[model samples]
Target chain A: MTEALLHVDAIETFYGPIQAIRGVSLEVAPHQIVTVLGANGAGKTTVLRTVSGILDPEAGKVVFEGKDIAHMAPDQVMRMGICHVPEGREVFPFLTVRENLMMGSYTRRDSDGIAKDLALCFRYFPRLEERQHQRAGLLSGGEQQMLAISRALMGKPKLLLLDEPSLGLSPILVQQIFEIIRRINQEQGVAILLVEQNAHIALKTADYGYVLEVGRIVAEDHCATLLGRDDIKEFYLGQKEAGVRGQRRWKKRRLWN
Target chain B: MEDAARLLQLVVNGAAAGCIYGLIALGFVLIYKATEMVNFAQGDIMMLGGFVAYSAIAHWGVNYWVGGLIAIAATAAFGYALDAIVLRRVIGQPQFAVVMLTLGLGFIFRAAAGITWGYDSVGFDTPFTNKTVKLGGLILGDDNLSIIAGTVLLCGVLYLFFAKTRLGVAMQASSQNQLAAYYMGIPVRNVFSMIWAISAGVAAVAGILLSPVSMIDVNMGFLGIKAFAAAVIGGFGSIPGSVIGGVFVGIVEQLAGYYLPAGFQEVTSNIVLLGMLFIRPQGLFAERMGKRV
Candidate 1:
């Protein structure tokens, strides 16, 4: 893609002393859905955090809209139109749903635009509107997830960093959420860098995909191409041949060598 | 009939005293809710506010109303600077260090105030001074009544600010989830400083309202100890609960002072505090919650 919206150039991040993301580079073109597929502790969330400025990379650049934003404060990155919806749907439990949504537009002063966006969020998640006055802590897990997405949308972000959107949801709910995410990207032109462990669905929803294995990128391809790869089908999709089920073995690395 | 009238007078006076404690407790609650640091200097801040108002009114010859407002604004700015210049650096420090820092700050404030305002207890005359209002055969000091009325009015304004205004909601969001608030483009550090300013401003208001009833002295900040009791009784984090707890302590103290021995009144609040801890340590309106994951 020409002129990417978010470009991560070999970022290396660490938690205390242990390196989490080592020499990982990727890009998301404007309005494109980019997914990072990995197992637990594969540094998927670390990549997203690095982009959103929650965890500053020890090295390399995170360039957004042609501006280098590595090591910037999270609020500054957010003000530059990059909103991050962290994992676990961290809603303000003490605040009502409406108040939580109001926080999304805290950086903006245009009341009319905020009100319109509020309406747009309610349109996407009707359940949120129904519980607008209730405390956010009272909402169900599914509803909280919906509220988290809608809250991010209210910020009118140019790039959205979403960590594990399909986490802890039924397959049907995941499908519904992903459908709205796709529509949001299509209609509002909000670029997304989604991180997920649910590889079966992540590939179907994203346009481009990156496979991470223990702090490094092992595979990168178009979503359709990644789906057809022999390794992906056998390991990620559980499409094993007869008598090969439940066996965990790796063929020698080929692409990098 | 005389005893009943005396009791009624005592109750009204107790309520007024309770309101002062409530306002001071509010300062503690606001700062604690936002930054999780207990400002042991909260009462000293109020003392400083009172001295400032006294200077503005007495030396500058300003009106009572204007001087009170100036004191509140000045104290609020001081609170903001206190956080920005010093407390912000200790964001990740252990809680015990903050307590020690604030405790040290309180001693410094007292010494500073003593140097500037002198060790003598000072007073200024107000419209409420030496005045009494009669209600149904019960006589009450106008000074005490004004404190109650002012607290109610201030609480109303604060409630509207927190519930209706965008900045107020932003403050709540920052206190609830700092990370999520940052994602929403909130300057969480600035928001925290603002919370400290509000807490200081509230303390200043309490000090000014208290000026007519009590003398403004360097040692007056010791009242903060009682406010701690009020906050604990109120459930430490809740707003309305703090005020209610203050009132309870005030009334009980008044009753104990009149009916029981002289020394018993002084220890009434402490007794109640210990009793509440034994019975329900969470306070009256605590929002006890464990962080989600």
Candidate 2:
């Protein structure tokens, strides 16, 4: 009922001639966590990239805080308080961890607010504080993920578009990162639009979920309802039935239509 | 004692020349760092700066300091315009195209300078003309001392700029990963233009320093080839490495010209460059870490 913090209308994106995302629409309310669940090459990353203005969409709109930012540059999008933690944790390799965090606040001019944010980032990820002077490339995968998330937080974003937070991490680290994500959402009241392959944790953490196939959103619902669906269980939750793969595939096609 | 004094003098002279080469090499590193494109016009830009300063001082009758400032400003604007007009269009193109574009631009700049200023070598009058300073046992020319002092001062300023300033850090961030920097609210295109401008400004300073020692001419742009070798030897990514590499090349060239065959001065830098390529293609201070995933 209330207005969404971010509204993504039916956006169509392309890579040269090949269309990557076709008419994908989504929304995230203030302080809510919405997850987009799909397998690799299902246009999950493309959706995030389109919203973040890295790749301009050929159609539809990206409205952030009631402003149409569909044609803005990536930096202009970030200036409007939308921070994107891209896939692969592209932290500056040669920069120290502290400097990496500093880069997150590049748009801000308030020194006091920046200092506060830096302290807050270090508090959330104490390992960052411990190796604040160390180059970011030297950090372990889990640590780098933490640094990446914390770096996004430093932007003081009203909405965070996370590409993949649990990518290439141990189970324990995934849980830890998800816990931090939940805490960040709740404590900071920051909205999140998360794209993930780990449907279990994503469904557990997010309030709403969307299922994407190829470049289209096939299904979407409240997380609790979606988690209980048969298709979601069979496809995303890894519920396997011997000799039923083809049958399930046909059934899924029927369901999508 | 005489031998020691002679060696010290050679070292000092080599260091002065090396600093000029390093200044030009710094331009190469700056542009290469920001865009991964080598600007072959760097040396020609230096020559252009020298001519600009010469015109300002000789024809316009401006003060020496004012002329130097004009030279730096003019060259910086030219560099910025070059990036904005030509290089910006071919940003994501192949490296070979960028290289050839810059090489062609270098030739254009050289020809422009020759047509504008004529081919005759001209002397630049500086305040330090014919001045010399006596050290403990050695005589040091004011020109060499100023070159060394100018290099040290410029390096210090650059170090502080990169370490302490926000715009400088943003430039560094953009150089490392432009997309990530853009996501972080840094205008990456502006940062690239600024890098080119600063590089050109630095090259101009090198030209101003070199002009007082050697005559200013279009052929002075050929010195950029040596600076290119210096950049390769120092590791293209490292700023400090460029200076050290420049100095090493300068010393080798000086010593070779003195001790080896008459034509060996020109070949010494290439020999060192080939040797560096064979032994350590990554250069002396190249980052050892594998690319991040």
Candidate whose DockQ is highest = 1
Error of 1 at A63 (Å): 0.4
List of clashing residue pairs for candidate 2: none
TM-score of each: 0.98, 0.97
TM-score, cand. 2 vs. native = 0.97
In order, the Cα lDDT scores of the candidates are 0.91, 0.91
> Model 2: what is its DockQ?
0.81
Clash-forming residue pairs, model 1: none
TM-score of 1: 0.98
Please write out the lDDT profile of model 2 over residues B134-197, one tens digit for every residue.
Answer: 9989999999989999999999999999988888888988988888999999989988998999
Per-candidate clashes, comma-separated = 0, 0
What CA root-mean-square deviation does each model show from the true structure? 1.4, 1.6
